[model samples]
Structure formats: structure tokens, C-alpha cells
Target: MRKLSLLFSISFFSLYSFSQSGTMQYSGGKSADKAAVLIVPFEPFMYISEIDRQVGLENNLDGKAVKSEFAKALDLYLYQTFNEQFQVLSFYFMEDDVEQDLTYVYRSRKLEYEVLPEESTPKAEEKLKGIQTKLSKTFKKEEDESAYGGQIVTERDEKNKFMNAIISDQKVVDSLNNRYNASLYLLINQLEFRNVYGDFTQMEGNTYDRIAKVHYTLYSRRGTVVSKGLATTPFPASDNNLESITSTYFPILAEQIFNAVNMDITSTKN
Candidate 1:
């Protein structure tokens, strides 16, 4: 009986570990002391999955509204967590002046990378749009021309879009740094909520585990880039709401992010 119990425990532990996976990638283990970091308002990946768009059409979903809510939740969490040492100051954006339009990317079991706009948009109107838009839309199938569209999303795209938005906001970052008495600025280039498979991947499977990825760049007060870091939850996918990802899985990732900050700041002597 004891042996059976021990075996069960080991099995469960292994499965738990296998389900949660993440990484922390950064450059320069240097430091930045007295760094009152400015956390610019978070941005979503300027992306809309075909599925999300259709669901929006059916359910009247507003991607920006959804993202705004997510941003608020995330900002509150970060403030509560990091305000002490870093003097974390957050900004909320109301208007965006970026000229580029948001694009949709189709992800599915077969494809493993981002499908370019020129590659996927036109077929959205074709019969077998989105998922059914064929491996290559050029080889149009006259029979399936009546099919509608669909879409899929991954964590990577969200991260990229968020990062790009901040990169474009360089004009304002310098001012914020000075006003906040910040020696460093922490901006999340990407903070996305997505479901991962129990297999720690999105390829296909029924296990709806949840995971999040955050890409941040720390800049000096003068706007000189210091370090870029990534922190992902070591949790599997779930049907849970986005807010819970931070409460449930972010402790570990948060620690890594702050650790990177300390490593950078503390390593640099006065």
C-alpha cells in the first residue's frame, strides 16, 4: 500500500512539472540603483485572431476594451508587487497615434509560425476562409469558395505587438523617466493571455491550460537601452479567466523579472 501511494505521488509530481514551462531571457547582468522605473501603459499585440474577430462579431467583442481591462488588472498587480523598491509608476493610454493597422494571424495544428497579412487577409472573404483558407490560398478551390473565416492566436504575437507599440513611444519615454525620478524604465512589450496545451504547446489537444508571456525592456533615464527581459508563467493552460493568470502563475515569473532588475541595478556600483 505504501509503495502504491509513493508511486502515485511521484506520477502526479512529474505531470505537474511537465505541465508548467517558461523561460527568462535577458541581456547584461549589470545594475541600476535608485532606479524609479516608469512602467508605460501596457499594450496588446495589435492583433486580432480570426476566431476572436468572429466571436467579436457574434458576441460584439471589442479587442481594445478587452485589452484595456486586462491592462488594468495587470498594472494593479504589478504596482502591488513592485512598488516598494522600484517606485513603479504606471501610465494608461487613451489615444494611440500609431499609423499601422492591427493585423490577424491564423494559427492552427498544421502551421507553426505567423502567417503574413499578404498571405492570409484576402482569403478571409473567400468561401473557405481562415482555417479552411488552404495551405496556400493561391490554389483556390472553387468548390469551397463559400466558406467563412476563422482565426487563432499565440502568446508570441501578443508579445511582439505590445513591444512594437512601446518602441514607437520612444518620444515620450524620456520625459516620463525624468518626471518619475526614474533611472530605469520597465515597459512590457508583450503581455498576453493564451491557452497552452498540457503538452506545453499550442499545436492541438484538449487540455486548456493557461499561460502568459511578458517581454520587458529597461532603459536608462537618458533613454539609452539597458536590458531586455522575458518572463513567462510556468503554468499550463486552463479555461480560467485572464485575471487569474497573474494571481495563480505569476509569482515565479514575477520573481524572475524583479531578479533581473536587481541583477542589473545592484551589479552596477555607485
Candidate 2:
């Protein structure tokens, strides 16, 4: 009886331990390689928009807020998606650090700018002249306005060109070769955000919605572009619920970025 009781207790404990291991299983895409990957902290860039900038400008939110939220979401997704196969390392690069080792940088020159509400009529034309002056100081005009709200516009201007060039300088490349021993670098240029608004009359009173579109590019360490990916996600502004929406969508955005990187790595390996 004693021997049997001991055996049963041991079996129970073993089962409990197995259940508590907290191991995650990945059954989604192809597995990642087991080799260690140094993921440089994703550098954040600007998207020209009033709403996008307001998150930091008026809300008193800083870059750390954005970084923290992104890191949390990305860490969770990566763990679920790749933990079983690859060992991931955080490569946090400060401005100084990146300046010392960056090999290739990504820069975007805006090719379009359009204000909603056509500037065709005399009154509209006058309003546009003022808007154009302000815009010209900031953004270059690519083409004349066609439609009022949903028209496409193109413009050319340098927003963060200087910083990007410095990151891709020869000095940075030499440092990367000497210090981190990194062979590959990724650059995301031109992550664009466009605002879309709509109104509808329905049984439930009125409905309004806003959406955002993102465009980006990926480049290799040696200045070879690996891939380009774009994502358009909806962001509804209802009673200041922007933060919650941002939290939800950022994970999706991170996943899209990860997918781009994974594809590039696979292509290079093949």
C-alpha cells in the first residue's frame, strides 16, 4: 500500500509539473531558424498628418510610450510565432550607437500633397492659396488637385533625409563591420499615413469613420532593398478611443513588419 501510494503521488506531481511548464506551441507559418537573430530596435519615423502627430504633440506622449507599447505587442506576437524555433535577441540601438554602426539607411521624399475640398471655384481658390503657402513651406506640390476629398496627390520633399543619410554613411558601415559583426541591415522608408473620413445616415443616427494607410520599404545591410510592404487599417475616432485602437492595430502592424522581414530573410537564404 505504501509503495502504491508513493507511486500515485509521484505521477500526480509529474503531471502537474508538465502542465505548468508554460511552453507555447507554434503551428502557424514555417518555423524560424534556430540561429540567434539580433533584432535592432525598430526605428520610428514620422507620418505627415494632424491626427498622427497629435498622439505625441498634444497628448504629452513621448517616444518611450510608443516604443513600450510596440515592444510589448511585438514581443508577445514573436514569442507565439517564433519562440519554438528561433532565439531572439534585443538589439537596442541608441542614436549614437546606430550612428556608429549603421550601414544602410532608408529615406523618403514625399511626392504628393492634397487638401480635401477642391480649390476650383474663386472662393476655394483663395482658400487654397493660403493653404498652399503654408504647405509649400513644408511640403512640395506634386500635381494639381483633381477631386475634393478622395483624390490622390503627389509631392516631393525631404522630411528626415539628413538623419537617414547619416545612418547609411560609410563611417557607420565600417563600424558595423568592426563592432556588431552584423552583415544585414533593414531600412523602412516612407511609412505613409493618410486619413479617410466618411459620413452616413442610417437608422442608428449618423456614422463617421476614419482610416489610416501605411506604406514602407525594407532594405538590406549592404544597401540592397529586400522587400516593400503596405498595410491599410481602419481607425475610427469615437469619443477619444484612439489609444485603444492604436494598441490593437499596432500588434497587427508589427506582425506585418515581421512578415516582411521573414520573407526577406527567406529570399536571401534561398
Q: Please give the range of 10 consecutive residues that has the lowest summed lDDT in model 2.
A: 16-25
The regions of model 2 sitting more than 4 angstroms off are 1-45, 52-174, 190-192, 199-207, 213-215, 221-223, 239-243
* Tens digits of lDDT, candidate 1, 125-225: 23212211112122222232122211224323221222322233454555444334556667665564443323323335534334455556666776555
The TM-score values for the models, in the order shown, are 0.50, 0.45
Error of 2 at 226 (Å): 2.3
User: Model 2 Cα displacement at 102 (Å)?
Assistant: 6.0
Q: List the residue pairs that clash in candidate 2.
A: 110-155, 111-154, 111-155, 112-154, 112-155, 185-221
| Model 2 RMSD vs true structure | 15.4
Model 2 C-alpha lDDT versus the unseen true structure: 0.37
Give a tens-digit lDDT track for model 2, residues 140-256: 322422211112233423221211212434554454445443344433332333333232342133233333433444444464545544433454444223346545665565565
How accurate locally, in lDDT, is each candidate? 0.41, 0.37
